[model samples]
Target: MGASARMRLQLQPPAIMAEVERLLAGRTRDIRLKGELRRLFQERSWPRTAKIIRAWMTWVIMLDALTLGLNAVLLPRAIALSMILPACILPPAALASAFVWTKPRAFWLQRLSITGGMFFILMSVALVGVGAGGEFYERHLNIMLFVATTAIIIFAVPLRWTLTVAAMALGLYLFFQLHNPRLETGSAVAATLFFASGIIATVVARRTMNILAQKTFLLELRDRSRVAELADANARLERLARTDPLTGIANRRWMMETLHRLWSDGMKGRDAAMLMCDIDDFKSLNDRLGHAEGDRCLVKVAGIIQSSVRRNRDHVARYGGEEFLVVLPGADEREAAHIAERIRQGVEAASLPNPASRVAPYVTLSIGVAAQAPDDAIASPEQLQHRADAALYLAKQAGRNRVVLHRPDPPGS
Candidate 1:
């Protein structure tokens, strides 16, 4: 119907507006049944609520005191202080204090408090007409003081609150001015000026808050984006560190770290086995296929070996260019040998296309298996890997593609 409403309707298509209306109707069902505003207020942060409570308390106590004091002292004798200007000072002071304690930060609170104190001092000037016999109705000092008070309110309170207070004060002042024109004209004019000033101040305050909220939101979004970027970088670094560049298996570093851990536990008498494997004729394969093909072949072999070991504690890793290692906790030499053989068979079964083969098969592996023993001389992870490597050499020498189990040297030897 209205221009703004028509603009909004154009922005939202008929279907979208229908959906929005449905959602609003659904939400309003709950609103229509609600009377829990007090409970909602109670849930506000404690310090914020405490500041608001202090404002109301200050208003009650200070306003009544100022009214009584004006009646008793300033209004009565019209002493050095003409009709108490505190009647105007009291409300502004209370409102100023409210602004102080409810300030967003401690720094602003101090600023507002100083403003309130200065306002009170300037308001005391209302006593200039003291000893001038004037009816309370004929008080120009109070009118001037009220104008100053409105200026104080514009600076002290936030926009919405300022507007509300100004509007209320203006309405009452206008009503009184209508009833008692001769007496209330000056004060009425002062009130109107303040009301206009309060409206402007309120607009400025709302604009400032909107700007601050926008900046804060953007800052939070930027921080979250930075965190997400850091997380992605860390994940990429971890993958690079742990994985083999050539074969895509866990690298030697991961293998050594795991074997070191297993060996340490073995020193405490925990059972674990290691299987060291080498691709037989791997040097020949490199000579036959280019380095690229060799790398692809190795990756394929690594996949086969990894699949052969199934236990939770079984770990397979790339030891070197054509070598791999496995750590099998709770496995003896025989069980480790069986796993090695299975891996060997799986590789042999691959039957890859080989143009340059001395033997008929494309690929095969030589595997050496060894188990940790508390009584063994292997005291460290290096010693464990050394023994497995030695066994692997023995397997390569014995035959191209067979599993070999490590046996301790004779005691005398």
Candidate 2:
């Protein structure tokens, strides 16, 4: 592998970051992240190894059959027959491995297939040389070593699997070489050592590559977890900015934003309305009780207004101290007045205690209503809000607990 790109800094879960740090710190031999890393590595590694093996198996069968045919046609018949017949074992073995790798199977089953199949392929290569009986015997042994070397380099399985394949390949090379009648003890040992050294080097390199891949996987998990955390944080901040903490309702900022959006030029022909509600004798209630009790009253009143309005079509917000604003879509002044009256009755019925009030024994609200019909030439959202504000001033001036609709002064009088 070329130089790895640097991983970026990101916040992740503590347990995952710990595991990633441990692996980066070169502690590769232990169970990772309480077995979570193990499962994740397998999920990523298994399919990659299977794909390489599946493609290789097809090529192996074809090449083995071609070698057998070519040997029969070009070489002497006795030598060819001996070599070709034993080598026939290779094609079917490769086919069997292909069948296993092409389909998904249990982990243990895949392990067995890889381990067992490598042995079969390597042994068949050695047996072909044995059947050839002369100079071909030693020559075929070299071919087997060469084949094993390639397998070790190409199959990026786990370190254990690589070690197992390396051990089996080296053992087979020595076992068959020692039995050769033409070779002396010294030569046999030398040849085995030479091939064994090459296989061992290849196994070490494969292990390094595997570790790098696992480290990359850990980095990916960190980035994904960080992205999730950032998204959740942003959502919460947005809510806090738009919502009143005391009443658990939308704040003035959100209400103004909604009104501007509804009355924007692009939203022409849409009908919208608002209700400006004030708690009558709210100052007296706060002075009589404490601020904590006032908070409770605000929450209760907010809930009442919320329940009275259409769920999604109307938005209720705490406009400021002792006041709430409601944005209603598609409601005329008459529909708005009806909604305001319902809110008035709901708050009066709640009986949240304001003996100091002049309106009644219980808490009361005075609401002002204004609406924009589809045909009306409302200049801006602020103008509509001003109309509602004017209506609220009128209601307060006339009497405390009542709903008053803002009727435009007759034709600019």
Candidate 3:
């Protein structure tokens, strides 16, 4: 095949995978789910892998030391000691690598330390194998050690690092075999079989771990999305509960709670006020103009009351049919009266024609203003509301289209 054609064939798989990734990313927005998946995998798996690698390294180092001590009796003192010295340094370095693994960002350093340590340990054992003898016993023992160490490295470390350590150990093994002419063909074949088995084991273990990690990432993303959707649903429910469906103002439940809060503040030395407003002769207006116009009238009055009370702490609610309650948190009697007068005038100015009966030709409001001083002895939200209602009755009785201040009942009357 031509070089260009060969190159295109080689590039096709990666190009197809890239296109698939792009399509998935476009569907999922700019969040880079694949990148997040990888990050989550690292975060979740790295610590456990580090711990396993550390434990395996410790065991291997100790075993190497013990083996060196045993071989010392059979081999030359110089050769055995040469092996023992390098083996002695490995366990401490392995333990230090465990410490490095505890740092989240030091994963690469930890991997490097672990892979490098395994490479050196295998290389040191290979050195001993070369120097000891060219006999069958020595070759067999070294081959077993190489196979065992390869298995440990592959099983303990992640895929990329395992491949690296395996490559280095295999290279060192080949180098040793090349230098030793006395090594038999059968032993070489056996060593090749062992390396192949380790490679297969590594591939199987790594693939299994990657599959599990991907499943975990997908499950976590689904759970996060569900939680977010639940939170939004709850917020919408809360808004619906607090708002009046007809006029779109605060509902009675929200207004009562707000009034109780204001009462608490009033007890703590802040004056507050309440304005209980009713549409002037609303029943006749509803009967004459139809309930639809009545509903529109309520919505318009609610808007006017909401707009008239400019203070952020002031709250307005549809108290009941044809009635609204305004709570001003810090307003005293004079300020309360002024706000109520403004609401009354605002309703009159709207000039919604009420051609039925006694009030004005246009729609009007009778607002009852009730102010509470910090020291006033009104002990309950009911009492406060009652005082405003009483004033509202007086405003209706004294003719509509005006604000009336609450006058508390005379003592013991």
If scored against the real structure, what TM-score would every candidate get? 0.57, 0.84, 0.67
Model 1: runs farther than 4 Å from truth? 1-186, 195-199, 260-269, 355-360, 374-378
TM-score of 2: 0.84
- Which 10-residue window in model 3 sums to the lowest lDDT? 5-14
Mind giving the per-residue lDDT tens digits that candidate 3 earns over 1-413? 34553333233334444543454445332323344345444655665676676666667667767787787888777766655655565566556665666656565676777667666666655665565554733573455456545544345445566677666766666566655677676776677667767666766666565555555444554444456568789999998999999999999999877766766755532576788999988999999999999999999999999999965778899999999998877689999999999999899999997898597788999988888755577536676678888899999999988899998667899
Clashing pairs in 3: none
Q: All candidates: CA RMSD in angstroms?
A: 13.2, 4.6, 9.9
Across residues 1-413, which tens digit of lDDT does each residue of candidate 2 receive?
11122122344348767777766677664424337666656665666787888777777777788888898898899999888667877777777877887766877777777788888888888899898878888888888788777777788776777788788888887888889999888988998898878888888788777766777777676665678678889999999999999988999999888877776747542577888999999999888887888889999999999999998889899998999988787888789899999999999999999887888878999999888855668546677777888889899998879999988787758
Top lDDT model:
2
Worst 10 residues of 1 by lDDT: 32-41
Q: What lDDT score belongs to each candidate, Candidate 1 first?
A: 0.60, 0.81, 0.70
| Local distance difference test, candidate 1 | 0.60
Task: Tell me the deviation in Å of residue 269 in model 2.
Answer: 6.1
Q: List the residue pairs that clash in candidate 2.
A: none
